[model samples]
Target chain A: MNQFNIDIEHTGDYAVIRSDGYINNLGGEKISEECCRLLESGCRNFILNLEKSPIVNSIGVSILIELIERVLESDGKLVFTNLTSTIAKTFRIMGLLQYAGAFPDELTALDEIKKM
Target chain B: MTVQEIKEIMLTVPMIPDMELAVTKTVESLSRFIPFTGDQVDEVKHAIIEACMNAFEHSRSADCRILLVFKVGPCKLTVEIVDHGKGFDPALVEDPKIENKLFKNVRKRGWGLKLMKHLMDEVDIVSNRNGTVVRMVKYADAYRKEALNESV
Candidate 1:
């Protein structure tokens, strides 16, 4: 099984990152690094599709929070899509849902971001 | 080993990277006997990860080892993560907030214990100069009550 990998696709103004595998510290850093590249290129909207990568530790989730801070500082939007209920609940408990938007899937997040 | 001994799995892992994953793999094997739902197993795995990470992060074990025990009970599965390292006061650990961590220069990585406590049904922490052991329990769902009873 793939330990951690990311497939980034830029659709119009938003970027969709499909993650496959466990979101450990390294996996989290990969997502953050990819987002950093997108941010530098002036992409403001992000859709993190974690349909395949559902499991995450606090360290990895903590990195996502830091990413949210960076994205917010840049006046950009960061949203998560296709989160397992376990991850959704974990996000809620960690107060991540407050900082970042969560949608059911990539299409929904992209549509919502387009509306914004 | 008796049948009772077979139900209890003890693992000792070095304090290295990705050791938590090893524990999770063993946990998956244990699921054959315990009817953990998809969500419950994920919660258990995540809690185990947090507990192991806590040992690696805070304990600073001189021996660089973590001892884990998985016990199958009548209605619950108990996971114990033990470390022989310098322990800190859980009371002193600050509760991290996104609001405080985002804009301000505060720490944002103290959610391990909170996540473990939230994921597991019950969490007990015993820490001192000797070591720290995080004991987490997950009660089986009512869907398969007799399965566990018959197995144990």
Candidate 2:
């Protein structure tokens, strides 16, 4: 399948990336590329909307890890919003909840990002 | 096997279009017997994709092929994925209850094994001197019941 479809939008310091479809190894590559694209545009804060994305493979998870690392390394932050229960569990199990923040709703995530 | 059957079925292919089908037609033949819902089919597809990609990405070989064999019986469906790469530790795969925190160091990526275990009723990984093969099974009735309960 075509990894994932990415949509980019900006608000203040945060760059929101909305992705749908299977996020596997190929998906990870695309996400990484998009993260790089926004970083080049000088946007650091990120909110990843995975609500529409019901499934995520380990490779995709790894990419998210790398993205989180990238953000943390740059002294920024990454948040996940609108996550399906399964994907949310995967992230939680993978220890993503420690470094990254997850919001029950997008407005909440956006609100938190505004405060940051 | 029958070339005709292989051609007619949805065989697994690598992410790359140009290469020969990364998995064999036998793989699909085996899948026919395994009982899967639309959702399960998607999960198996994702699991296979992750496993094959691990072989293709981590190993040196560029054009390697992974073989998937599906054996469907009256009550159960079994999938066997064989790869031509050096195997790693299955122990390293993370537990799903480890809390919501990313592990630092990132010495290895092994959540794929964990995914397989969660998706399949039974998962067995055998990595020896002769490459690696991961086997998974799903029961038709049990899956249906669980899926029904979840939907309700």
Candidate 3:
């Protein structure tokens, strides 16, 4: 099993966390840590691109929910871009849409965040 | 004859060996009926592995065997994962959507179940009466359309 890869890229005002591989318990923790590190660096806007990632378990999902809460608490917004349909549905059922928003592609998510 | 021709298949494996690969291939083979795409297949496989691993670790059986039965129908595919252990309560499990991070550790066992429910069309479990039987169903429509475009 390959641990998920997280790449942090900053474009002026927004930061993107591009993840690849299975998002299980370990992957979830890694993602959470990365998000926290970015927040500490004064980068609040986030766009998670899960296009290369195929499967994400509940652990990953919970970590995402935590990220969403943390972002909201700091008046920052988190958007998920390029979600696989299964993940999109999972986010929906988990009611993540109530707090976080999703876009079909990364560019759109970035645009949405800029507008906010 | 293809995987679609088969009705049911039973697999019993010792919990000591990590059964993730076996369950992944088995479920992928049955994708003919469920019509899951490569990505959907991966999601389902991960969920099953998590469920089985939980049984292998937390369940009270020292040397227990896990039984996975698959039933393939014309319109749906169903899987029953059974373990002879102390069993758990499905109703008591909290929703993973809640922001309470405190509950994550306590309900770590049910994480697989939650993903299974989210990935599959239906998920039902019977616990305590005769151990735990996790039932997962995937509709043909979910896979058939995708199958037409991709090789299963």
lDDT of 1 by residue, A1-116 (tens): 33788999986667999999889889899999999999999888899999998789888888888888889899889999999989998999899998898999888888898887
**Best candidate, TM-score:** 1
**Cα TM-score per model:** 0.91, 0.66, 0.78
lDDT of 2 by residue, A1-116 (tens): 34468888886677888888767667777877888788877788888888777667676788788778778888788899988665666676567888889998778998997787
Residue by residue across A32-83, what tens digits does model 3's lDDT show?
Answer: 8988888887888889888887666666676777777777777888898888
C-alpha lDDT of residue B134 in model 1: 88
lDDT of 3 by residue, B57-152 (tens): 666654488889888876567788888888888888775545444224433224555667767766788889457888876666555556435533
Error of 2 at B111 (Å): 2.9
How many angstroms is residue A69 displaced in model 1 relative to the true structure, after the best TM-score fit? 1.0
Q: For candidate 3, what is the DockQ-based docking class?
A: incorrect
lDDT of each: 0.85, 0.65, 0.73
How do the residues B31-144 of candidate 1 rate in per-residue lDDT, one tens digit apiece? 767767889888898899999998988888899999999997645688889999998788887777667777777656789888888888778889999999888878778734
| Candidate 2 C-alpha lDDT tens digits along B1-152 | 33322322233344352122234234444556555454555555555555666556654333466666665554455566676667666667556432233445543365766666665667778875456777776666556566446546
The candidates' DockQ values read 0.68, 0.36, 0.22
Using DockQ as the measure, the top candidate is: 1
Over 4 Å off, model 1 = B1-6, B143-152
